[model samples]
Target: MKKMIAVMSGLAMIMTVSSTVYADFGFATEPDEVAAVVQAYIDEKLPGKAVIEISEAGEVIVKINKTSFLNPNQQVNILTENLRSYLLSNDADYSIVRVVYDEEATQPAEPTGPEEPAEPEEPAEPEEPAEPEEPTEPEKPAELVDPEKPEEPEKPTESTEPVEPENPAEPAKTIKPGDLDSSGTIDVTDLTEVSLALLGDRNLTDDQLKAADVDGDGTLSLADLAKLRQYLSKKIDSLD
Candidate 1:
């Protein structure tokens, strides 16, 4: 009975060691290959550093380095979902155990040599004073000219007829509301123009603005766009 108990104890010890060895050494496929694939996927999808580790139990551990500009939790969730789908699609049995942000170790700053002092600038020399100009001689007085006599005015001829004024120019044609393209009818083209205007991709003319303001609120807004779309889709009878 004592011998039997010792044998069972030895077998249990061997089994425990074997399990540990298998876990440490990895499973059937190389863990490095799995890690490489995971790293590649992370590099392609995200814009940060990541460390990938694999266990014998087919668990993929991902440590994502934290960044100041992004939300770590959100990034982890996104990566988790996408990577899981990607691995499953490729028939990979390995599953992501957990993805967490790791605080990266701060690198030590390099020691810098002492800076040299700047040299003092030399003082500028003073400018010399300008020389005085010589005095000019006085000019002689000119003689005065005599004024000319004025000519007599001519007499005007009398007319009996009166002149008529020219006709005024015609007024500009008014553009119909919602007819942005001025195609004589509102259609998809007009809708596209309104969409472009709303998106700030295209500048609308005064007439186009008036036409695009289907709601007549004096501004082209999403409400106007919705009304225009409804009119086009026949959800409503007219933009009016």
Candidate 2:
């Protein structure tokens, strides 16, 4: 039964061949940095009847046949597990896998559409301006009085007694030292003048502010202020 031995040996050989081919390497995944290099290797080796899925999430799924016509174990260990390890070393975190079932090649769903940006709000219209205030009528002016009717000059006297020509009155210089502050008093306004003098602010308009600044050391300063205080103190004492 040399014939029986031959048949049995042949059967054993066939079964071993079948098991080598049909084993599985399981996962679903995406393309990563090493994706291109891995892909090139796979394309060169497996060629056809293989699928690669590269998800946007960076999951890499390499699906090969449960039955490769060529080196079958090579398809599982070296290609599948080594690829997973390479991706891990490069920074990919979680991943899943499954064998390529002879029945179906699962395709992940496509996203619907790009997200739309939000719109800006429209500005509200400004409220209309309020009505302008009404103007009031001015009061009537008082009638002018006749100076000729006063006792001082009811009429020109018919004087024949040598009405000597009256001398012309001199123009009045009304700016008094006390009037600098215009309070009709010689108090703080004069002191303020001294202060300005200390600051070199000598451009006084009324000449009143400058004149009250008696110490005229040219500029307004604490020196002038102190002088003013002393002058005022003396003046006040004299008033008693």
Candidate 3:
């Protein structure tokens, strides 16, 4: 039993030592290992000025301390090309973290106090304006009168005086004595009608007989026809 216990103690010591050494061989923290890698890159690429810093705040932070970094533009160029190649080749998981300077350490901020609230000013009271007086209406002037009385309008004259009507002209007579055919004169036509009546060759109307009688005799004969011919020859002035 004593021999077995001694062997068991020796085995446990060797296991503890081996595990400790193995852990030591590995990275202390992933961030520290990344910082170390970044530092080597800075030294190789940047040379004398820039460096990488690793620290623990609430968590491990890898920051680029650019306190004496000579060329920021050159460092930026290296980060884009060489740094990206390094991370990709090494399979680093720092794609999301933006590498920038730890400026909060170099420049300390001044302490400030809470500012006092400003007092509000009271609004001024508005003044009341005076009421305007009503405007007075001007008095109307007396109606103008003409000194001379206007001429009295002329009264319309009534047609009281009796109107004298003009005499009417007599109508023209359609028949004449000795005008046998009522041809408007005692001529050969009247004689010819009387001759025709004597011979009974033509019938004579009462007005024709009246026209055929040239001497104002009631009867029509050869004597009346001769008188008509004489009148036509202008031997008698009037056949009235």
Score each candidate by Cα lDDT.
0.74, 0.57, 0.64
Sort order, lDDT high to low: 1, 3, 2
Best by lDDT: 1
Model 3 global lDDT (CA atoms, 0 to 1)? 0.64
Q: Evaluated with TM-score, which candidate comes out highest? A: 1
User: Where does candidate 2 stray beyond 4 Å?
Assistant: 1-170, 200-202, 215-223, 233-240
Locate the minimum summed-lDDT window of 10 residues in model 3.
101-110
Measured with C-alpha atoms, the lDDT of residue 79 in candidate 1 is: 67
Q: Native-vs-model 1 lDDT?
A: 0.74
Model 1, 1-240: lDDT tens per residue?
999999999999997886577557553234565566666676676545666666677666787766456688887787678776765555443443457677762223559999988888888888888888888878867855545755568777787688777777878878787898888998999989888888889998888999999888898899988898898899999877
Compute each candidate's TM-score over C-alphas. Answer: 0.32, 0.22, 0.27
lDDT of 1 at 69: 64
The CA lDDT at 75 in model 3 is 47
lDDT of 2 by residue, 1-240 (tens): 999999999999997765454333222123453455455555666565456677666555667664455465655665566656654554432244322333243233457797787788889999999999899889889988888785564777787887788998988666654346566676776676656655777556646655554555544446556666776878434211
After superposition, which runs of candidate 1 have C-alpha atoms over 4 Å from their true positions?
1-164
Model 1 compared with the native: what TM-score? 0.32
Worst 10 residues of 2 by lDDT: 22-31
Write the residue-wise lDDT of candidate 3 on 1-240 in tens digits.
999999999999997786577457652325655555665666666554444544444222334446345565554554556665775565443443245544342322347888889888889888889789899899899978877879689999987988789889888656688776766655666677788998999898877877777777688788887777777789988677
